[model samples]
Target: MSISNGIGNLQGLSNPVTPASATVQTGKEEQIKSSVSLAPGAVKTTPVTDQTVISSTSELLTRALSGSDVRLDKIQPLQAAIAAGTYQVSSSDLADKLITSLLK
Candidate 1:
């Protein structure tokens, strides 16, 4: 077969077929309507209020801290020593505390 004849047959096959138009009847459609209404006393709503209560332990802790003395001069020296890696803990004391806690 000739190449031109084969290409022409392919071009004719590639042409799209036209689809038929759909027919619709009008002026006979039905419509639906809906609504909702509540009676005067149907839903009763009360005013909402928020309250907060502090526990006795929390109140005591707040009062204790407020009246306590914080020795910053002593604390600053210890903090500096710890930051400089010069603060040392006794191994005997640490082991004793660890064993005590473990036993408890």
Candidate 2:
């Protein structure tokens, strides 16, 4: 078999570009712009109508994140009691709490 090539092979193919029709309008309306003339030394302030409020949970979380995880009020008394050799903890209660945390 021999290869054939010529413009005759492309006779049925349509042109890729399309020309615009005369019925379509191409003109656009001109927009009118005016300048504002304010009095001398006049200041314009925009009024704010919306305000953002922080939820209680978000405020508490922000405070907790900024402050230490350990509370000073709870830790101070415990530290003092331990230093005075009066701090007592039950073994069963501590073990139960540990096991409960592990299960969770």
Candidate 3:
């Protein structure tokens, strides 16, 4: 056995009421003007200047990242050791560094 629910009858699913278009009418012509006037003493004008001060730490970092202080010779071996799973960390050294950073 089979049943037909008339799912193809889209006319029954549509809205029966239609919306009417709205019309707006306006009668008057007016001119709008905006103006601002400041008294002589009301406004204070000072020379605008901008200044930037780099911290010593940031300057050091920038210098380091400029590739001048990078020791690729030392880093390449460390990277290779790490990739080979043979890199080792000294417990005392690691603890000392952790404490130093925490203190900072």
Candidate 4:
């Protein structure tokens, strides 16, 4: 089974490679969209229609806002992309934090 940082049916799967495989094909309208599967019951072919990407993002956000430890391996690529300038942080967010800190 395949897992993303926020989404997927996961179905008690613990390993990466098996008789089955899943890959995430992230996109614009859909951020961390997953595609590709394998084997008989391989990737738990649930539509994931009920679960929007927003739900997934919100779940991860709830964990973050709670200050819980997250799986770093799941986030390493994003960190690298940001560091490499392939990704960006909005100036609005940065400025908001700076102003909030000054007010505090």
Q: Which residue runs of candidate 4 sit more than 4 Å off their true CA positions?
A: 1-68
lDDT per residue for candidate 2 within 48-86, as digits (tens), equals: 899889899998999888986787999999999999999
Q: For candidate 1, what is the TM-score?
A: 0.33
Best by TM-score: 3
Q: Which ten residues in a row have the lowest lDDT in candidate 1?
A: 30-39
Off by over 4 Å in 1: 1-71
> Residue-wise lDDT of candidate 3 within 1-104, one digit each (tens)?
97879865656633332222222224322111112223334564668999998899998888778866667999999999999999999999999999999999
Clashes of each: 0, 0, 0, 0
RMSD of 4: 28.9
RMSD of 2: 18.8
Task: List lDDT for all candidates, in order.
Answer: 0.64, 0.66, 0.64, 0.65
Top lDDT hit: 2
Given candidate 4, what's the lDDT at residue 11?
70
Winner on lDDT (1 vs 3): 3
Q: What is candidate 1's lDDT per residue for 6-88, written digit by digit as tens? A: 53553454333232222233433411111122333456456799999999999999999898497888999999999999999
Write candidate 4's Cα lDDT for 1-95 as tens digits: 95588546567555434332244335643322333324445565566556435678898888889995778887998999988989877999999
Deviation (Å) of 66 in candidate 4: 17
Which of 3 and 4 is the better model by TM-score? 3
- Report the lDDT of model 3 for residue 77: 96
| Cα deviation of 97, candidate 1, in Å | 0.9
State residue 54's C-alpha deviation in candidate 2, in Å. Answer: 14
